[model samples]
Target: MSQATETLVFIPEDISSARSGAFRADWQMRSLAGETMGTHWSAKFSSPEQLDLQAIELSITQNLDTVISQMSPWETDSDLRRYQKAASGSWCAFRPEAFHVLERALSIAQETDGAYDPTFATAVDLLGFGPSPHSGYSYASPEVQQAFAQAGYQKAALSAETNSLFQPGNLRVDLCSIAKGFAVDLVCQRLRELGLENYLFEIGGEAKGLGCKPDGLPWLYEIEPPPNAKASLSKAQVALCGLAVATSGNYLRYEQRHGQTVAHIVSPRCQDGDDKLLSVSIFHDSCMEADAYATALFLLGAEAGLAFADKRNLAALFQTADDLLLSGRARKLLG
Candidate 1:
């Protein structure tokens, strides 16, 4: 990593609540702060908007966690549960903002042909991500498979006028589709509002770079598989500016099932796991789009993913398990 000309590590721990998914904020900022006079703003900043953004993020995450997380039994009592309680019924009222996000998710799902949707709640649930936090894997009933199999986001209905979301609709909305990317975008908005034009906004592995680092050069980062794997960036680096970059892969999120490696990413068409394209990195004007496409591309496989990206004029890179980075339209954009 090249030295950052100047860096600011502003982590207002006391001012911020721990709702951003145990992020790499502290350590990442510390790494950037090494031997620098950059201020670490763990204290409440002077700007009210900064505090407000933090609060909003925490609240949104909590509300989302309420729906998606099986952590607490009571969270099932939420609007999502309301739909489940209908006992083979009709539409229902939902939190307006939640519904908005859900509606967006469904739109992406429709556009992506179910590649990105809340329907995966069942797939993820079976993989051990609910109330227990990490359920690993479990033997599920055929009936359970049938139940979840029917839970596609397309089944849900949303009225912009009513601003509510519900099932056909027996499904619930999960924003694993775009929540982290949304949060990154929101943080960028907040930073811009605070006159912090030059900053890197990141949540999860999704990140957006704005302006240059305190140094004059553009912000740069290498792509690597999740930790525990040996260094895999191939000594290649991408400079990020005014764009979001995200990577999704299977090696780190796989389990042995039926004598095969069952990964988190389920192909909506095959209902099977796709392992050919180990990782996909996408860059776009919106982090949400980038994040969404990263997953979508992974599901698309190499040939189809390139075709989709080319058709959309999207810039993307797909890394195979063998460590070859294949750029689709993205190669020209990086220049």
Candidate 2:
């Protein structure tokens, strides 16, 4: 058995003791047919990059973040801002690749029946989303609330002709859905640039493992099913066959405010629904896809989310807040 161990290495901090800033990246490898890797992360950049390894990490991640920034409604000065400022409904042009990502978001939105939406920016904000400073943006639209209940991601029109978007000005999109996965893609690209084929890339809770580790083994990841579920309750080995894994749940983000346990995972379609299911983990061909899908599944709650996964033929694990039986597909994946 190849032993897997993680060590935090910094080029600036360790080598030169420079005060540039802290950059966080993980490089854990093992040598064997298979090995296990585990990391706990929160999505988003905390500090800065100040090391050689950190510089390499920044070069890749910053580019990835740029792609997501162009997609996020959260950015005040973003290219997306033009649409928000459109006098009526204006055409918002996107880079071809960026447009493709939006197109993909729309596609997944359709596949999930708008259950996993990218256009939840307004709803998310109204529910007091964003970082610490920008809190408490309330919802005042019975009409808007109704809109969310029957929200269809198809409502937004994309013009590959103009590389633009046409939707209600209030309709904003957030790439947090698939951005982490996309970041993994960028990270992998950079790893290739650095001639690193055997490495694991994890951002927040999303992960993408490429090739074998330095220890020479397939990457081993742990699966955390929803709490109180029959699936592996604690950390255990999961087969890592070049797949990216992501989990979405409200267990950590919940806060009791004014008698309501407000969770950040908002249903782009529901402003107020007591979603009981705790968390959902998805395995997919790519980390980005899996990340977005898992988040959407978590937002869909227990029944609808599971149904959506079944329809898509994706493998997943779902654990509700209280112990509940999962369908055949989820059970098998979690097991």
lDDT at residue 235 of model 1 (Cα atoms): 39
List the candidates' TM-scores in order: 0.70, 0.72
Residue 183 CA error for candidate 1 (Å)?
1.1
Superposed Cα deviation of residue 170, candidate 2 (Å): 2.9
> What digit string (tens of lDDT, one per residue) describes model 2 on residues 238-275?
44435667878776655655554566777633335465
In order, what lDDT does every prediction score? 0.55, 0.58
Looking at model 2, residue 48 earns an lDDT score of 24
**Which model scores highest in lDDT?**
2
Which ten residues in a row are the worst by lDDT in model 2? 7-16
Q: What is the clash count of model 1?
A: 8
